[model samples]
Target chain A: MSVSDTHRTIDAIWRIESAKLIAVLTRIVRDIGLAEDLAHDALVIALEQWSQNGIPNNPGAWLMTTAKRRAIDLIRRNKLRDQKYSEVARNTDLYTEDDMDHNLDGEIGDDLLRLIFMTCHPVLPQEGRVALTLRLLCGLTTDEIARSFLAAEATIAQRIVRAKRTLRDRDIPFEVPAGEELSDRLSAVLEVIYLMFNEGYSATSGNQWIRPLICQEALRLGRVLAEIVPYEPEVHGLVALMEIQSSRFRTRVNSRGEPVLLMDQNRAEWDQLLIRRGLKALDRSQKLGRPFGPYSLQAAISACHAKAPTAPETDWIRIAALYEALSRVLPSPIVDLNRAVAVSMAFGPDFGLQIVDMLGNESSLKGYHLLPSVRGDLLVKLGRFDEARKEFEHAASMTRNERERELLLKRAAECNSAH
Target chain B: MRFMFIVKATGYSEAGGNYNQKYTDAMIAYKKSLAGAGVLVSAEALHPSSTGIRIMYPSDSEKPEILVGPFLADQELIAEYTLIDVDSEADALNWALRMPVPTGCGEFKIEVRKLKKNLGFLRYSGTCALEADLKDQLSMLKNF
Candidate 1:
């Protein structure tokens, strides 16, 4: 292979392997910030030498070995500074390659769980937690994250810096919280994963409707978490949610990559493997015998779709009921908005409009483009073209996604023609 | 000497609104380039002053004055910190001069100064205990 090809191969390897590398490194280093820095140092070395040397047969092993060596170097340098840094570094060196290989077999799940918990630690603010997790665990760039949130790159960049510094400054322990703290931290972990999945499902700002790489990463992480904390009902719930949602990935976009709305998608295109995984996860969630949390309830709703042979065969009433349960457990304006759509499908547009109208005064939905988008769809169904047109136009104006904006504007034009 | 740049103080309104992805990508590239050159130590964008209060020590008194504001002014916010492993301020500025144009907005500034160890004052000052106590209080307040 040419030098550029080697560079490309290394880049691809990093994208695929960085999370596991960091997870394993953090296990050894016990400092997330340092683990990430060491990972990057490995990446830099790969970028420089891989071109001439060609890609290694075991690229992951190469990266891991390089990162560990870099970690040792960093520690040795720090050893010059203070007794404390030296002592920590000395303790770290006790684990050799044999120890690492052995530890890897035992600690893959535990280490990933630890990394997730560390990223979502309560000390960092919510945005910081999400941004940092995406950067480290999902291998997303600051630009990718900013685009995902429709946020400024500078803003995401700043959030990440502060997040790392905050973690370092506070000396937050790199481990999963146990006991009561376990569930609370687990919820944060699940939230971060779901947040990642959601951004991928409907990219907040980009031209594309979905970012499959992000969704895949989230699903992989969720699966890892489920393995690490097999008994945590919520972990299973989250995995179930992601699996079912991901089943529709192929059907969600058309040949041209334009979004095909849920109702318009081809049922045949859904991945049966993902659906089966999702159903199994849902069964696992229920087997735990806990009341269905928000994710599990959402999964149950998705299972309704997975069971259906076609859109017309979908059990709308069950979906509506599940949404109601979701609302009770995690009553947010977005859930209510979604419930309105289900209610409209199950009952009638008039009934759905009533619930949606109740959300009209919700401050949270004031700028949340989806509210107006759903309202427009319902209005169009009710033959309220002028109002629907206005709603679609409003939604189109508010959305940052270029493709979504185009679709919304097209819908608005359709309403105009109908009128 | 490792120099840190603090963002300047200015109105959040004057800082303008949140930028778009294109602007943000540019900033990331800028930071990456700086990292490549080994000049950029660290950079962070703070939450607008609206999210939290800002407190500052008055030169005349030990107690700091609180203000509800962000780092809005170019002079107030320390935009970039250029840290040179080699000797002094001159070396730090030499690295800072290579930084690309400000990523998204108004005039940006860079400050070149030595990181204060303050070991002597830390040893002699009676206030060190109080400072430690304050840090403990702040740390306690962090999560909630």
Candidate 2:
């Protein structure tokens, strides 16, 4: 492979393995900041070596052992504070090459959980916690996070810096909170995971439609959370949601990264195992005998799609009813918008339009592109080609994303060409 | 993130007629989902633009001018709107993409734009004017 190819390979590996590497190092260094630095050092070494030596068979193990050794070196060279020395020494003795290879190859979830709680400690503000969690847990670069939220890069950078400093200065314990505190902090934790998964499933604005790496990280976090808090229905709900969503990851975008509507996507590409797992998780949520929450409701909706043999066979009525329940439980314009879709599918385009017409003056949706896109679809159904073309044109102009824009413009062209 | 879904007014809608049950049931369900998500901040349908008044602020600002509706209504259509709080633009887009058609006649348009939330910096300064001016930019007045 070329040097650039190797570099790209190394970058992909780093995104996948950096969380575990930093989590393990933080346990040894007892400082999140220092742990990240050590992990970066290991990554730098990997770039230098992998470019020359070709990629390793077990790149994650290579990275972990290297980082651990660097922790030992920093301690040996007195670069680290004296307080961290004994812990580093303990880590050095315990994480022999073979041991680290075994651990990274197996049970690194515990470290990941501790890392999550530590980053999300109530000490930091909620935004700080979110920013830090994405940075540490998902291994997203600051640029990526800022782009994801449409926030200034400087703003994101400042938030991350302050978050890390607060965590270090406060000397936050690197362990999961218990009891009442656990439930309180757990929501924040879940939000972060959900955001990460969404970022992976459908990037906000980027060249690619999805970033599978981030989604996998979130799924991992969700799964681990479900394991630790088996009784928590929400955790299972989130896991099920992510699992189901991810089953469609392969079919979400085309080779050129264009968006594909669910009905138009190749369902055969869906991962059956994941769909089964998601259904099982849903069953667990139902068995809990509690009313469905937001996540569970969405999972239930996705289940409808998964169970369908084809797009036309999807149970739009059941999905519509579930959406009704979800809206009653927690109402929002977006939920209402989705409900409009369910209603349309269960009923007809005209019915959906009536649902959507009331929202024409929705202040929040005034600038939203999909609103126009959907309206255009309805117009086409009504055979108002010129007006449909205009709506599609309007939607095409509103989006900052290229793939979505292309899709909208293509729709506009179809409307223009319609008889 | 916060976004507003705007439905543009068309001449046909201004005639003032009740939408059918298909539209009604779908809309009811749609609104319910928004409520269920707990992200529906506000939603309201504008009376056909003819029922509205336009106030224009000129550069000289000698006096605020007012004009009546249905003047070039074809050119200016602000029909109805719904606001929501979702995870990101992508989430808002997904929700928007799934919305039922909103017009009984020909075509309708709904536009979405992000709403500026009270960022940490903005909250500290409490400056709403600057916030409005900087709404679409990357300058976030957020603090940790």
Candidate 3:
């Protein structure tokens, strides 16, 4: 194979293997920073040696073996500097077993879960936890994480640095929080996954409207998370929400990659299989018999859309009620705006306009482009062409997505010509 | 019309020193109000002037000059800014007047400047087609 071809193969392999390698190493090393270094060291070795020796048939095992050797070397060399070495090293049977590979595979889920919990440790800042988790657990580079979050690379890099240091200095255990602590930590983990999915669903700031790769990674993570913690209703709720939302990924953007608004999208293009899976997950969450949390409520909202044959046929009344419930539980102006949309569809533009108009002075919505967009839609429905034109133009300016801006501008122009 | 509210730096802010929690709280509250009103366009807090750099082009085109700060005009340096589109200059001024003292010091100053109009000067041909091509190129590059 050509050198570039070898490098490409190695890159793909690393993405699949690196997370498992780091999770397993973090289990042994008990230090995220050190575990990451060891995993990186193994990757450097793979890049150097794989080109010469040809790619190994058992590449994961090869990386694992290489990383474990490095761990042993690190423990010996930095035995004095590293407190973790002293703690885990004293236990001779920790990583030196002949059946270490089998053992690592056996406890891989636990290690991955532990890694998730550790990376999302509550002590670290929210953004930091997310940055670190994406870096280690999802095999995302700092640049990818920054782009996904619509943040600067330097900011993400610093957050990761601070997170790893906090993990070490605070001696945050490399295990899932137990008892009362478990649910709180779990929420943060779920949040990180959801954040990743949201970025994919509707990119916050980018030329492209949807980032399917990010959504796919998030869905994979959520599925893995669901497998690890089957009893958690919220986990199922979150998974259901992502599945249903992701079902429309193909329809969300047109052949030209322009965004298709929910009401305008071709319903036939929505993925039925994913919708079924999402409904099943929602049912599982409901069967748990707990009060519906934010995720399940949102999933319920999405399920309403999935069941509808057409946008006009959608159960807007039920969605409005769900958003009302969501506002009571997870109150935010965004929810209020969404509820306004549902209310407008279910009842009339006037009813929704009242709610939206009340939020005119809402401080949180000032920089929010969607508020103007939603208002513009309502105004158009109300036959206020001039007002609608202004709102659309305002929204177009606020939007960072190039296609979204273009669509908004098109709407503004249409309103202008009509007026 | 859109106006830019420039927050002038003070001696306290330029030293890279920490401020009281209430100072940050007030700033957050101010930003929240701007966002809530549906008038705010964009906002950002600039880093200390020490980290800033300026490139000066020579008239003769022999060479460009690069200048790094701590620029001597520390007091004149911008600490932050917010852009807002309001109905009138008076409306913009009202919002600017309502802005909280950034450092909780009684003597904070903010300057609001109206942006130059884009309509007259930006009548370029094939702008949409060019922008579309550029957008495709950018999206393609983003995957890396």
Candidate 4:
């Protein structure tokens, strides 16, 4: 292989092995920032040696061994420095090479889980959590993570550096939380993953509607988490929801790059494999015998759409029922709005209009464009063309997406022609 | 992103030569690792070219031509393929590089190609930003 090819191979190996290497090193050193530094040190060493001697047979193990050696050397140096400074500091916990060897083999899965929890800890800001998670758990470079989020590379680098510092300063334990704390911490982790997925699934601020690469990364991370925490129903639930949603990615927009509503999407074009995988994940969540959380409830709703042969054949009643259950578990105006849409499909536009009108006074949804959009659709169904046109125009004005605004204006025009 | 790793057919593979126990064990272990990472979408080995047929359109007329295989050029034919969904091309390459070498099968090649997914909006709307960002990121990776 050429020099560039060898470098690319090393980079690939680093991507695959870095997460595990960092996770293990953190456990040994008990410092996330230091662990990362040691892992990178090992990577630099591998880049030099692998090109000379060819790649190792087991690259992950090779990297781990190299990183562990560096960790031991650093600890020894720190111990010597501490001994010269103060006698009391000599008693601090430090691992020898033998201790490191004993601790390295097993519990790597647990170490990774702990790493996820640490990165997604509620102590850090949401953006920090996201940046840290992508950096530590997904093995993404600062540049790649920056590009994925459409942020500046230096900003991402600073965010990562600050997040690691916070993790160290706060002295967060390198273990998964337990008891009631476990569920809360797990939700934080799930929220970070879901946020990453949504950032890709729907570009809230960009001209592009979908960023498939970010979604793929989020889905891969969710899958990894699900394997590590198989008993956590919500983990499987989140995976199921992402899988089902991702199946529609191809059909979510048109050839001209206009948005396509769920009902208008081509059912035959939806990816069957992903839908099946999602259903299987949902089944796993159900088998865990826990009450459906927000994600599972949503996945159950998506499954209803996936199972339907066509839009008209969708089980709106079941979906409405699921939405009602979801509202009780995780009440929000957005859930209520979705419930209203399902109710309209299952019952009548008047019934849906009543719910939508009630949400008119919802302070949280005052600036939410989807409210007016849904209300407009119901008003049109009820033959209130004038009101529907006004609502669509309002929605069009409120929306930030150029394509969605165009769609809303088109709806308003349709209402005008109908009248 | 999703990638397909296509293992090219070799003379030994085309002749249906059996793999030794060591190679078979290594291949199984490699597949297990792929599944453990939750990246393996599907993997399958194809039957020899003799079992396959190809349909071709003759350019001069509307008529079609059917050809039976035992086709020429073993290097051009695929013996097997594994599809994996990963975070990036680098991650896919990482997995591909770890694949066990097939011993006593002469030399073989695994070609990696990304599966195309619909990103019409990104292509049409964010072409400049996306291409420029990707180029910048590639250069950054090269520096590392």
Candidate 5:
């Protein structure tokens, strides 16, 4: 392969292996920021050498070895800080590629989990938490993070930098917390993971409807969590949610990256592997012998879709009931908003509209784009074209996703033509 | 030192806040899992920015002006906050590191500044503009 091809190969490997690489490196180096920097340094080396050497057979292992060597060199260079050097060097040899590939299962999952907890730690702001996770776990570039936010490159750059500095200055631990602190921190961790999954599921502003890489990484991490914390029902719940939701990736967009609503998607396009995995995870969550938590419930709802052979066969009433249970477990305007959609699906537009009207004055839903979008759908069903047109326009104006905006506007035009 | 993991809300982050049955269940399950493991302190998703405003530094340095709705920064978007008390900065940061991005739409920035020591300042200085400013800007602000 030519040097360019080699570089491309390395890039692909990095995309696939960076999270695991960082996860393992963090365990050895005991620094989330440093682990990432080391991983990048390995990337820099691969970029320079892989072109000449050809892509290594075991690319992740190669990267791990190269990073470990660089880490040793870094420590030797700063021998003046010999004690610090020894602290890192002592564990350096312990991590052979196979050791990481096989044995250090506890550490690998824990490191990733710890990294998640650290990034989602209460010390850093939430934006910082999300950015750090995307960068570290998703292996997304700063530019990708910026694009994800519809934000400027420099702004994301600063956020990542500031977040790292904050973590360092505060001396945040690289291990998962225990006791009550564990649940608190774990919640933050789960929140970040689910958010990552949702973004990939329905990108807010990207040209693409699905960012497969993001979803894949989140799912991978969630699966790892499920394994390491087997008793934790929510881990299974999250994995289940990702699996079922991700099953729709194939049907989510057209070949040209245009949006495809659920009602319109070809059910055959859904990934069977993901559906099976999701269903299995949901079953595991239920077997934990506790009331189904939110994620398991959602997974159950998605299961409704997965089980259906066609759109018309979707069990809207069951889903509505599930949403009701969800609301009881966790109440929010957004949950209410979703329940309204189910109500519409199961009963009629009027039934859904009543629920939506009840939520009209909700403090949280005031600026939510979906609020108007749903209202427009309900209005269209009521034969209120003028009102629906206005609602669709409002939704279009409110949405940040260019694709979503287009769809809403197109709907608005339909509403206008009907009048 | 106690640290607040501020959950910053961007437009993208808020998009997934109100999800259908599946999404909400996923979030609640995750929250409950966190609760089971005993790590969650307190958390809440915030309302969309349309319900809020951005108060910027006024032309006159002594005053501030509030702009209506859409508080996302032109360059940086911050969504919400979470307050956590940990044994060390590393502990706080490790936890913050795991926090899911809001809706996974945007990034999260955790500002790990130590909480300021109250130090009887309120008692000593019964009334002051700085204190008033803190109250208005930071004091009464609850973590989401």
Candidate 6:
């Protein structure tokens, strides 16, 4: 292969193996920042050597061995600097090459999980956690994470640097939390992953409709998480939710880049393979014999739509029930608003209007555009066209997204013409 | 991006001979790993070409030509395919490289091809448009 081709191959191998390499390194060195540096050193060496010697037969193992050697060297050099280094040096001597290989194969899953927990520790700010998780666990460059989230590269770089420092200063243990702490930490980890997925699934404010790469990265992380923590229902639930939502990417927007309502999306164009994987994940979550969590509930709601042959054939009653359950578990006005939509479809406009009108007094949803947008749809269904037009106009004014505002305004115009 | 790993048919596959137990187990393990990683979209093994048919549209004639298979050239045929959605072509290639080669089969090859997106939109546009129209009418009726 050419030099550039070799570089590309090494890049791919690095993306696949870096997280595992760093995870194992962190376990050995007991410092995330140091682990990452050691992994990078190994990568740099591979780039230099692989181009000349050709790629190794097992690139991952090669990278691991190289990083471990770097870890041992760093400890040896710093042996007098700190007691921790001396201890790590002593531990390192117990492992020969064969033991290192066995440890990598056997302990990688647990080490990776620990790395995720450390990155997503609740002690750090949410943005810090997100930046660090993508940087360390997802093998994303700081520039890529910045571009994906529409942040300044320097800001992302600073965020990651600070996050790593905080991880070191806080002296977070490089192990999964036990018992009561486990659930909270795991949720924190899941939240960071889901937040990454949402930021990609929907551009909250920008002209861009979707940042697919971010969603793909998030989904990949979730899948990996599910594999490592197979018994965790919520992990599978989150994966299911992301997979099902991702399946709708194609029909979620028009060719002109306007927002397309879920009901209006072309069901035939939905990715069946993703839908199948999503449903399988949901099944796995259910089969774990635990009560459904918020993500699983949402996945169930999406699955209702996925299973429908057409919009009119959708099981809105079941969806309404799911939303009711979701509202109970999650207790957000947003869930209630979604429940109203399902109720309107399952029952009638009047019943939905009652619930939505009750929500109008909600303090949390005061400036939420979707509230008015959904209210407008129910009003239109009730033949209250003038009121519907005003609601749509209000929703249009409240929305920040250019495409969403255009869609709401179009709905308002349609209501005007209907009257 | 989505990629299709086209597992090209071998002489043994074309002859409809079953894979050895070892190869079958290895293939299963490979697919399990793919699914575990969440990159796997779909995987399917095709029946031998003898069970299939090929259709050809001739430019000169109003009628299309149909050929019954037991097609020639086993190497050109696909015996199985696995679809995956990954971040890049490199990632797809990495996954393709990990696919288990059938033991005892001569000259195993898996071709990786990136699938073009939005092709389905063109194919289903007419039906989707009709569905939208039908939905409009139904909503109108409900409103009245």
Instruction: List TM-score per model, in order.
Output: 0.61, 0.52, 0.63, 0.67, 0.59, 0.69
Please write out the lDDT profile of model 6 over residues B3-122, one tens digit for every residue.
899989887888899889888999999987766554566789999999999998999988889999999855679999997755457888898898888776778889989897612111
- C-alpha RMSD values across all candidates: 16.7, 20.9, 13.6, 19.7, 18.4, 20.1
- Cα lDDT of candidate 1 equals 0.72
User: Residue A388 error for model 2, in Å?
Assistant: 22
Put down candidate 4 lDDT per residue, A1-419, tens digits, no spaces: 87789899988988887888899888778889889999999999988998888887777777887887777767676875655323422333344444545655457789999999999998886777888888998888888887877765655665676577668888899998989999999999998888788767665233465555677888999999999999999999999999998898888778777656666678899999999999999999999998999889989988997998966677878987998898798887667777787777778778888988998987878998878888888887788999989999999999899987998899899999996
Model 5, span A1-419: residue lDDT tens: 87777777777899887887787777666677788889999999888877776776777878888887877777767767668767777656845666656744565677677777777888986666777888887778988777655655654565576677677788887787989888667767777777666655555233555455555767877887788788988789889988987888777677777756666678888999999999999999999899877777777877887898976777878988987887787676666667777777788779988988888887777788777877888888888989989998998888889987998899899987887
Most accurate candidate by DockQ: 3
By summed lDDT, the worst window of 10 consecutive residues in model 1 chain A runs over A203-212
- The models' CA-based lDDT, in order, is 0.72, 0.74, 0.77, 0.79, 0.70, 0.81
Q: Which scores better on TM-score, 5 or 6?
A: 6
Report model 1's chain A TM-score: 0.75
Indicate the worst ten consecutive residues by lDDT in candidate 6 chain B: B118-127
lDDT of 2 at A236: 86
For candidate 1, write residues A117-208 as lDDT tens digits.
Answer: 88998887666787888899878898877766665575567667767777878988878787898877888878777866765665423346
For model 5 chain B, the run of ten residues with the poorest summed lDDT:
B120-129
Task: List candidate 4 stretches off by more than 4 Å.
Answer: A80-106, A204-211, A361-369, A386-417, B1-144
Interface RMSD of each: 22.7, 19.8, 18.9, 21.3, 22.2, 15.6
Model 2, A233-288: lDDT tens digits are: 87888899889888887786787776566666788999999999999998888888
Residue A340, candidate 1: alpha-carbon lDDT:
80
- The better candidate by lDDT, 1 or 4, is 4
Over the stretch A160-218, how does candidate 3's per-residue lDDT look in tens digits? Answer: 77678768889888887889989888988988778667656665233465455667888
lDDT of 6 at B135: 38
True contacts kept of each: 0.00, 0.00, 0.00, 0.00, 0.00, 0.01
Q: Rank the candidates by TM-score, best first.
A: 6, 4, 3, 1, 5, 2
Per lDDT, what order, best first? 6, 4, 3, 2, 1, 5
Every model's DockQ: 0.02, 0.01, 0.03, 0.01, 0.02, 0.01
* lDDT of model 5, residue A376: 82
